[model samples]
Target: MLDVLSEGFKEAKLKLKGKAVLNESNVKEAIDAIRKSLLEADVEYSVTKNFLQRVQEKALGQEVALRAGKGDSRVAVSPADHFVMICKEELEQLMGPVNAELNMAVNRPTTIMMVGLQGSGKTTSTGKLAKYLVNKDKKKPLLVAADIYRPAAVQQLKVLGERIGVPVFHKEGADPVTICKEALQKAFDLGCDVVLFDTAGRLTIDSALMQELADIQSATKPDNVLLVCDAMMGQDAVTTAKSFDERLSLSGVIMTKLDGDARGGAALSIKEVTGKPIKFLGMGEDLDRLEEFRPEGLASRILGLGDIVGLMQDFQKVAEEDQEAQALKLLQGQFSYIDFYKQIEMIQKMGSLKDLIAKMPMQDMIPKGANIDDRELTKVKAMIDSMTKRERIGQDNLDRPRMARIARGSGRPVKEVEELHKRFTAMRKMMGMLGKNMGGLLGKIPGMGTLGQMNNMRKAASQMGQMPGGLGGMGDMGSMFGDSASKPKPAFDREKQKKMRKAAKDARKRNRK
Candidate 1:
């Protein structure tokens, strides 16, 4: 979502490379790049200017000893890395301290009044918030359809509530405030502790809308008033948020359509502008696609460092008890076709593969034009489904005749099945090698010899099934970042580079033939 900002930071980092320190000249250039990127992303002019000024002051004020190749070289942080880290820290500070919790009343049902302009996804966000509260917080939420002016707004809320298994309270021809007041009573009667008011929205803010919302607020005495903003609206979203907060005293914001081509300026600007935290990000249209906003995670993603914590959170959400065992087995090269199919299912549950990949660190390593086709996983699943249990578990049992039968059953070519088998075999071999060689690779690092031995012991225990499930014995991932910081960059190997180029040329020639 912050693709433009990410690219800009990457460019700025490159510009700082080989430079000694963050002096006025170099700092100006880097900040200019950032300024252009933010402006292009539709950030508010004042916010962008203030942010850049702070970044510049911080960068220029840092000790010269902190520069790359200065001070104690062993522990010296590179200027480029230092500058990027400053930017990352500033970005996080600008966005938030990670406050997404909804405020619930102690004695009564927590009335969460959802307010926004038309087409801002207020109704959909209401359903998503309900589902989140139900599944994550174990709250029984009653959805209120208070947007009586908009055609089918009530029906839409009902459909969303039905899909999410939340009860919808709507009374036709009722005033918005009256509907919300009645909805609160219904929540009390139905044992729903959370009441989500899906209030009406207009194409633009007006006195009539504001007065109606104010009336509803006065009657309901909501615990939390959240504005559902469209991230695509950019600066306008921030303006709308400020307007709403001024009137309704919004508790927080939910940014919808963040998965679209949003420049992400609103997400970065709204909290700073309105003095409200972003509670959730509406990543997609699905009722289950809402994500609690994590400022550190977003800042990491914006800096192209990826969000490992968010990725793990996503994994934890969909991971089954046996899935961890399966992952361990796959790492040990003992996984079968059945395990492969199950892994695919787990990934599908986690959401889009592209989105998942985007959360990986150093994602720029992926080929620029290459795309991950989710359909490919479905195709693989279809082929696996066509296979007998024996054939799935024992590849050696699948001779040409068996492969042909499976291909016919799967409605795919026999060659495609063969190719899949070949790739699977290669993957198993590579994973096996990686598992065995990981300790050695770690030991080769400057100060990780003890860690390498520990890793080996953990690996041994994992192989014997003595370790706990879900990477329990994999040790702390935080250590990896520490190791990376202390480790020396690898020297380029000319021979290896030449061989890679030659191999690529050969592959292209073979394809043409």
Candidate 2:
């Protein structure tokens, strides 16, 4: 998403090429360029100054050490390597640690008060966190509608609460502070373990809103004060974080709109100045779209490579505890529609369809203006729901009449039903091939273990699902394995697969050539 920042880093790294040492003269030019890049990315002016100063100090130190021939000048690391290391270390430190987990032990019925300016997705995040706690943490979290200024705001929270199966504590005409106080009492009485207070947000950091937030803080004495800043707001997000922290005594930050194509200077600068861990990230508008913030993965992503590690962790968390073994088995080609449906639900829990696509290594492989439709996921989900359990498990039982009946059940046309059948059949055939060649493919990608590992299975499932025709699509996993497999014909054949792989290999070879 931080395409601009990634490009700037690439440019800065290129400046050090052919340089033997990072002396003051050479390093000064490089540091100045980086400083300008940070400013252009909308990083706070003060943070940019101090950050560059640290990098410059490290760069100059490295140059001096190199001239002294410390140990081995023959094996001296490139200045670009050293430069990247310095930046990566400083950026990680600025962004705090790897991940931040929500606290549920802060005096039972832990109160989390959300504060931010309007359009920060404060309301949506509150519901997302409540859903996460209920589903992931197995805690009873009550969503309190304390933002009473906008009448529709309360209704919005209630609707989200209903959709996610969480209880909303609200009083339509009551004052926000009063509603919160009552909600806390209600939570205690109902034996709820967590309470999320959604406070009012203003257009900007105004005094009235600040004072109101302060009043809520004093009244609620919340265990965690989460400031929801929007990445699209840029440096203004930093300013908002600072202003909100001053009034609310924020415990952590939750940067929303992270899925946007902005440079993401806000997330980098917010944690730097606030000195508070970013507890959660709101990537989309869905109730289940919240992700725990991880600095290393985010930094890597801003550098333009996909965060494969982060994607694995996201899948790991969403996978059902009991379904782990089954999911692994399904990867070996015994996957039924029930197994497939569970995987789909896990994916839905992770985030938006667009978000998952953005994280694929093949994202750059796709041609421009290809009209890669994302709505197919919804269609797939609908078809799966339409099938009876017996039919889902034993697809051989489905004849033309049965297919039409299933299509009617799902409210989809018979053609759609046929499409699903074709895709599912393809998935079965492809998995058999993956079973044979997964070792080599898995080895090529670092951190992906054997095919049976949850990580590899999830990655393979996502990649396989995204190919053309999805499962029935010609480029599905069937094409991934060349001519070796015998008997049953898959959706794709040997020649098509050979062409795709040859094209991929040629592209890499051309880069070297």
Q: Which candidate number maximizes TM-score?
A: 1
Poorest lDDT segment (10 consecutive residues) of candidate 1: 466-475
Query: What residue pairs are clashing in model 1?
Result: none
Residue 307 of model 1, lDDT score: 92
Please report the TM-score between candidate 2 and the true structure. Answer: 0.69
| Candidates' C-alpha lDDT | 0.81, 0.74
Give the alpha carbon lDDT tens digit for every residue of 120-205 in model 1: 99998999899999989899999998898888888998899889888999887778888898887898899999999899999999
* Pairs of residues at least 3 apart in sequence or in different chains that clash in candidate 2: 423-472, 468-473, 469-473
Clashes of each: 0, 3
Residue-wise C-alpha lDDT for candidate 2, range 461-481, written one tens digit per residue: 554444334322334323222
* Candidate 1 ranges with C-alpha deviation above 4 Å: 64-76, 399-415, 432-513
